[model samples]
Target: MGILANTVSFRQYQVLGDPPAGDPGEWAGPLLAKNAFVPIDSGSEEISSGWVCLDDPQNGSFAERRDFFRPPSLAFTLRRDQRRVPAALLRRHLQKAEEEFLAAHPGLHRVPKDKREELRDTVKGALLARTLPTPSFFDAVWDLERGLLTFTGTSPNIAEIFEGLFRQTFEGLRLVVLHPFARARALLPAKLQPLLEEQNRAATDAVLEQIQENTWLGADFLHWLLAHSVAGRNSFRVRRAGPALMDEAFVAFLDNRLVLAAGPQRVTVAGPQDHYSEARIALDAGKEIAEAGIFMEKGEDAWKTTLKAETFLFGSFKAPGVKPEKDGITDEKSEREAIFYERMHVLAEGLQLFDSLLLAFLEERLAADWPKRREQLQRLLGFEEQ
Candidate 1:
């Protein structure tokens, strides 16, 4: 009971700042249209918003409810570093300020000014011990590496709220899910392939070709996705539940592999494009790291983790040093720096291409399926004139 009470007081403390002020949602465009969503009054004009909805009946299929794939918003306060504020100095400053104010105010108070000044000083110091909790939301910012959003909460969900927000304002924009299994697998070492053979063997090109015929129109592509997973394992029982096959949990296993393969490395940062930005080193002497970042994205201001996706798309390194067989005139430091910079550019380019691939995959799938899905929805809504 005590634990539950403390928990409720948490995000509960943030309700005031989480939602936007008033009804700016009137003019709101589709949530997915602009990278940053802004709500405004649209009046009688038709407007659409983008929303991600889960149709699972087990997880509340009722109208206007939704579990959040990301945190909607957050709230906290910011104050100065209390340790930096000296108690004696602050006391004296407060003492002077109060005396000045009282002298200026003249006939306002019958209370002894000295005692009142001391009380005010004590109260001021307590407040200034710098409580800097930011009631701020990192909503909509996706952590590309982790495949999750920042500032999310525990199990109690808001799926309906997400759906309602979408239906009311973003009736046309699209929401998408990106699977990075294939890309992550490709990044693994050749020696580790055997362990994931069950999954890889299924997603192979040959099996994918066979899946084309089984692909059903107007159905969620989830069926095709499952089939593809089996194409890698070569077999899976239909009766099997949850993630019916090895590949069904692609993101989970891939993330695990990334953690292992991204073992200790001499990570070198090379570009001045963000030279001023702090570079990151994974596998620190003491750290739990499946990923790392080159800027503050991994730290205090991580509203931009996905934004760094393009800057650091693919992460790996080749054998270090000039080949031992024939390397003569080498100022090693200079050589290392040059190589590092070259590597940085190559990484940036790869990230750009990878991001493009993710975008392309979603574009093709949405265009091909959404039209038919819309028809089905209309029929369900009785627009089919049955």
Candidate 2:
């Protein structure tokens, strides 16, 4: 992995134990870190993935810590979206569907009128169902920091424990809206660089040592799942093998591709579609929804798309937790998009501020190269080099 490259999910967890020691610097606990991390592509798809750290190392350790990767909860689904459609349009669609229904069942016309009326009600409901537009989402978050570990979590409790731990560990802490992998990479100066590298290495070594002593813990989890999750020629249950499945999931979480749903339902990306725009290029940028049948949709809202030249949010991964709510489109006159940019500017500013502080702590080592380094990264803080 490059300096900014990542191979694990560094999720913002509600650290359950202690609080930060001094300044209460806060930071989020990454996901898929057990801490192991996997890498992924820009579109939240799996590219190259692996274990950054395993509960049990190759050498034996906790009965193999294996996570059972299950598909999205889509099988037993109930439409929960609340957007309503115009009653008139619904009636129109229902009437057209009834005509087709009656033509298909000439014998039904001969039945009692009351019985037909009841059947019509049932048919109309199915026919009148309208599509709900996809939702628009934005990032909303806040935080404070302490010493040792950065305590950042969406919840108050997560932040509290994060603070406590840093207080105890005197490591450092961080709390903010965005994921810190890339940001954390940016924080390391020559002096403190070794600090983070040491922590990462220390964690890895401890895991390996534990495994060597407690051997059964190494692959026990994998074996248990292998004998159970895979049966009958790699059927629909699990599309990939045990190790590969876990590896991919870790990659997905790290990449923010794993979305948590409310119930047990299966979700799969609609295979593919075609599209053309102004001839600069003709291609497909679409996503599909498939249950008993398939529903095709296009546009940026479809399939979490981004134009090639767009300054894509780099918010590539889909993390599990709360799904963002969808509000109707804002009128251009409202300057909604501009307002949004302003808010994000504020957040990006706060993170950048902390970035400066993090660098200051290591100033002694980076003093020689700080000038050039700052010039290169100034764009991150809305500045340009002279």
The best candidate by TM-score is: 1
Badly placed stretches (over 4 Å) of model 2 are 1-134, 138-178, 201-345, 357-386
Model 2 reaches what TM-score against the true structure? Answer: 0.20
Q: Lowest lDDT 10-mer window, candidate 2? A: 70-79
lDDT of 1 by residue, 231-279 (tens): 3322212211221221221110011111211235433333332211222
Q: List ranges where model 1 is wrong by over 4 Å.
A: 1-92, 96-336, 365-368, 371-386
Per-residue CA lDDT of candidate 2, range 1-386, in tens?
11011111112222233333332111122222222222221222212222221111121111222211111100000011123346786567656766776788787765356755766566544433433322211111222221111211223343344334333422343333222222333456455665544323223334234223332211221121122222211111112222122112110001111111123442332222121011101101121111111111111111111101111012221111122234566554234334333332332332233233223323422346755654543333233553
lDDT of each: 0.28, 0.27
Q: State in Å the error of residue 145, model 2.
A: 27
* Alpha carbon RMSD to native, model 2: 25.8
